[model samples]
Target: MIETKDKKWSMFGHILMIILSILSLAPFVLLLVSSFTDEATALKNGYSFFPEKLSLEAYRYIAEQWELIGNGYLVSIIVTVVGTLAGVMISAMLAYTLSKHDLPGRSVLMLLLTFTLLFNGGLTSTYIVYTQIFNIKDTIFGLLLPNLLMNAYFVVMLKNYFEHTIPSALLESARIDGATEFQLFYRISIPLSVPMLVTVGMTVALNYWNDWMNGMYYLSANSNIQSIQTILNNINENIRFLQQNNVGTAMTTADLPSATVRMAVAFVGILPMLVFFPVFQKWFVKGATAGAVKE
Candidate 1:
């Protein structure tokens, strides 16, 4: 009887999870379908899982704006790559340093790091500092830096992984064998912390890829270094502005694929992440659970 009850519970759990999985995937499917949906049909009928008339008009519209889109892609790629690499290295190194209990001024450093996590200078102050002191505004660095770089929570996560997951004795043995601190970190700590690092790197990359606030705040709309998200946003805004002002070549706002284009823009924005995130999905899953269990 107990066995039968347990089996029933297991089946129920499986059914629940399957439902949730489908629910999670339904929006992406709808968004993809909507992007290819006919402008008139979509506008009249609203978005549907099975769009009545399929059209490439939305995609064609995007392709028509390919030059700006292409530049946005380039800038996003550069920022994601450089920012992810730099952020990961800095976060990992700092975390590794903090994990060392004997280091001088470690408490003070940790306090400062925690303070940042708790509080930040408001946007106005941050903008002034970056613009006046750092002078990153209107530059590629505008996209690369700002709030996305060097997350304090990520530092704490890495520090925990280094201290809890990595064997301290191994690092000590390397040190005893005359391995420099850098050598110990590079050879011993990093290799063992791959899962955590990959997880942190993925998060940082996503943050960079999806960011548009930095562009809106620091870079002008026409700035060549605007990221893909920023570019898509600009396109969306331009569409809205034109619609509001009744400005178009010949086609009225009513004739425009305004709604479908929004779906298309959203689809375009998330496509790369969808394609690439799954490749690292295993690492993400593993790393997320790595230091959770302490023995």
Candidate 2:
């Protein structure tokens, strides 16, 4: 009887989750359809959930501007990969050290790290520090350094996973076998913490991929390292706003599919994350739950 009740509840929960998932996905479906519709048709029809008329002009226009856009994509991919790896490693190390109660001054260090989470210097001050003090403005280092180094929340999550899930006896046994701290960390702890690492890495990668504010703050349009999100946003804004400003000019009916291009740009920009999310979903969920119930 209990098994039957549990199964029924699980089935009902699955049904509810499916409905919510569809609702969340509906807007993206509409956006994909609208991107294929002409600007005039979209404006007239207000973005139907299905394509009113199929067209590829927008994608072609984006292709025409592919040199700059492609460069941005390359830059974003490099930043995301490098930043995620570096950030996850650093965060995991700090988290592991903090998880060890034997470490002196760990509490103080944790408090200092947590302080940043609650209060940060305002934007202007941070900008001044990065540009004037660090001299990283308009550089690749500026884009990657500020956001890629460390995050308090990710540290806490990792620490929780280490403290609760990794047995102390395992570390003790390794230490008895003459395993150095570094060796144990690399060989033992890391292998056991794969789920958390994947979760944190994916989160950091997504942040780097979707980031536009960092680019706005630290990058110039003339720079060689514009991120894909920033480049796409600039393209969308220019197309949407410039057309109105240049109305009644030779460009008014120049066959530029601005609406479709915006959609294509969005589609291309999001493609990497879409590919990555499902690959990491199982590990992410496991890590999230493992970290959630800390003793």
| Native-referenced Cα lDDT, model 1 | 0.89
lDDT of 1 by residue, 62-86 (tens): 9998998998998999999999999
Model 2 lDDT at residue 143 = 69
How many residue pairs of model 1 clash at the backbone? 0
lDDT of each: 0.89, 0.83
Question: Candidate 2 residues 198-278, lDDT tens each?
Answer: 978888888889998889898886787999899999889888776667655655744556767777888888978877788
**Native-structure RMSD, model 1:** 2.7
RMSD in order of candidates: 2.7, 3.4
Clashing pairs in 1: none
Question: What's the C-alpha lDDT at position 280 in model 2?
Answer: 87
lDDT of 1 at 3: 100
